[model samples]
Target: MAPRPRFSSVPHHALAALRQRPAVATAVFATGLLAATAVVNRQLARKAERENPPMGRFIHVHGVRLHYVERGEGRPLVLLHGNGTMIQDLQSSNLIDLAAERFRVIAFDRPGFGHSARPRGRIWGPNEQADLFKEALDKMDIDRTVVLGHSWAASIAAAMALRHRASVEALVLASGYYFPTYRPDLAAPSIPAIPVLGDVISNTISPILARLMWPGLMRKLFGPKPVPEKFAAFPVEMALRPSQLHASAEEAAMMVPMAVAASKTYSEITVPTVILAGEDDRLIDVEQSVRLHRVIRNSRLRRIAGAGHMIQQTEAAILMAAIDEAASISAGGGSDPRDVMTTNG
Candidate 1:
């Protein structure tokens, strides 16, 4: 073997040229992104890390066991995440802490996210998941409370409002997709749908898939601008675990159909609702969130400038103010555009 001589550093112009070839640069960047989160997220668990403001704790309820962390127990508020992310989506998000101060913020892994058990032989959809959540609330002795959902959970929150309206108080939907359709090619787990095949593959190459997929998306999300080193790693590391992919796949399977079905049902909602979205969110289109705001009467729309789909993390302060405004209206106070950015003060 021959040892090659190394240069001191590549020139700045050379680096710029490499970046110009986006596909090459992005793929390399993605390779690094996936690996970093697993490292930092491991450290996050140390010191018995408290969940944002109210601290995280779990409970057992409904047919399936649930894992949730509750903080500041006054009004029961549930945080549901989008697909491809877990309760960590909220924990790793700015929304968790913002709500913990005023409302009893409860965030959990929906059925298949985080450490929750995936029910056998059940079709996991927004409606079914919402029903299970209502039972969890009942088991926790929470009769009526606001439901906050993001992306996929937005549909679930709507289901709760429409089906179990008596049990729901108000609604907050952020970066939502109202279920009328979904991207099918990507949602299904690469190797899980078969009978004998799922069993064989689950035992075999699943770990590898989790490892590679986690980092790649992180890189893409942060492409134009780099995401903070620490934040990017935690969510992916938490997502690529065992039951995580299985649950993500299941919900994704039912996602498109349920979304299509739910879109038709959106006009049925009569709850006091608040919709917040990033004017620049690249994941779910901003128009979808806007459409939702227009359709649901007694609903308010908030648009944050330059923020992406993960507004809770990217524009934490702004997102909090929007929530505060939502709370004010729900509490019977006069809400105006003036209240929109008031939290900045």
Candidate 2:
């Protein structure tokens, strides 16, 4: 008191108050951390966009903006990439270029992936996406074409064929989940799809966590075979943006339920179907393809050796061949001897 420690006495009182109100202190610290994380995420998202600009054109349809890459000239082939990827995924696989040589390839970002806009207030299940894509294709004057869906998009492809039978001539389903299966891994990612909580997590923590986990995930996806160098060109940061992360989370949340709903209608698919599966797919069982092939009477199953979930990257040639097979089979070829093409792993 005699020393007149004015500043020291004030700080001691403030520290005592903060210690007394630990809950408030925790809330304050959390708020600051979240604010900082949000700022960093925004900067990173902007940088990603600047580094990886859109490689295709945009089309506004049904109150949504869709991004797509068009190439070559021949029978129309519409590519629907799986969850967490965009047109670049197909392009990176070289399937787009290979198919472009023989078919008019149109690869889309599908609702929320890449540069596409995904409007909220609606559940974008397989049927919903199928409806949107159907309207979009119609707007572009694509009355009928071969539709290829990889992984989760496989359900969308099936929905398109089921809903618009006349429009979807054939289907190429790769690494697809046709039936409901136990997927505990989806739990963590699905958290970002929750309403208020999802918004906060996607904007703050998901992107950061994804950066750390990307490599291991890629390895698992392309396991049993080394990941191709070309896949490194994929803009991982772009996919890590908050909006895309939310979209991916939503898709993960919808995967099982969508499969449950879609499986009931698979046997009704009369279009020429080609089921492509990686024999050594670590993520999904190849038996999924086998079951799908059995269900779809007009389907052909091609199991690749030494391949994984990313058959597009590991077996692009085989994918191209499958596309050709879909096109050929769709052209009214009566019977085929090789309904099931299996190569030993």
Candidate 3:
């Protein structure tokens, strides 16, 4: 009892000292908070992977491992997902099945997203990713097929067409950001891409923040239309993993710059292209697709009314029609304007 009374007094004395040295106390609190955050995030990532295991095959190309889903049987069609997501994004949208009906669909989990390896020490802009996928497709013996890119991946599709003009037979760009514009909101999420600070943030607070903001982000992405029930199959936890958070942040940081760099070569893309977008896309303006259609001379444009940025999920029927039109055009077949649905170009 006497010893306990002495220890109690010691704690009081230590508390008084810590209160006097506010800086030390603050540092201690910060350290504790970070430790807790790390523990929680680590557990969450493990749980996410456990619950949602990889459902596709893997290929090693140029020292990178890519996870991809291969389905259907016809001309090869490559599906490239947008920022922050994996192949499952397209799979959940039913786009894979729909396209697989007429084409051999191959949807890739782009570098750093999903189960793919995103090696550090090099920048992975749209062009770099395009080259990687080109090699991977070559290894898979895919020579030419229509390439569909949604959101950020649209840039990658364009880069692929420009770099290997003969490989991409056609292009279906949907809700893509093709030009640089003022995007102040990107500043916050991009913090996790900043070297040491980025590592710490991505491993801790970034995932937490992403989880909190996911609903609103989904709402915006599929706005003017409710987020489809099918999208529930998308593993939000997987996207919230620390690794994906870093990849997403990096993409966000490079979005504007990549757009500016890629925009210069848009005119050189001679592939048959079709641009699709929701008339009321809340995440990226529908005008982006309209403008891209205007730039690509051999492009068809379809602006779906009452749709949003996640047209892949909400407008899979319309998108499938677009893919069919693209494939037909790639084969030198012409589009029947009556079958063109809602063409503006």
Per-candidate TM-score against the hidden true structure: 0.74, 0.94, 0.93
lDDT of 2 by residue, 1-345 (tens): 378554557878877888999998898889999999999999999898899888989889889999999999988999999999988899988999999999999999988789999999988999999999998889889889999999999999999999999998888999998888999999999999999999999999999999999989999999988888999878888899999999999999998898888889999998988899999999889999999998998889999888899998888888888888888877865535438888543
Q: Name the 10 consecutive residues with the lowest summed lDDT in model 2.
A: 329-338
Q: lDDT of each structure?
A: 0.68, 0.90, 0.89
Q: What CA RMSD would you report for each candidate?
A: 12.1, 2.7, 2.9
User: Model 2, 322: alpha-carbon shift in Å?
Assistant: 0.6
Residue-by-residue lDDT tens digits, candidate 1, 1-345: 899998757677667877899888888776566456444434442222333222345566656877787777577788887776766666666578778888887787777666566777877788888988888888788888888887778888999999998887778888887746457554446445455555444433454566776666654443323465447435454465545655666665665677778888787787677788776666667788778876787677777666667766666666666566566666674443322221111
> Which one wins on TM-score?
2
Q: Is candidate 2 or candidate 3 better by TM-score?
A: 2
The 10-residue segment with the lowest total lDDT in model 1: 336-345
Worst 10 residues of 3 by lDDT: 336-345
Pairs with backbone N, CA or C atoms under 3 Å apart (clashes), candidate 2: none
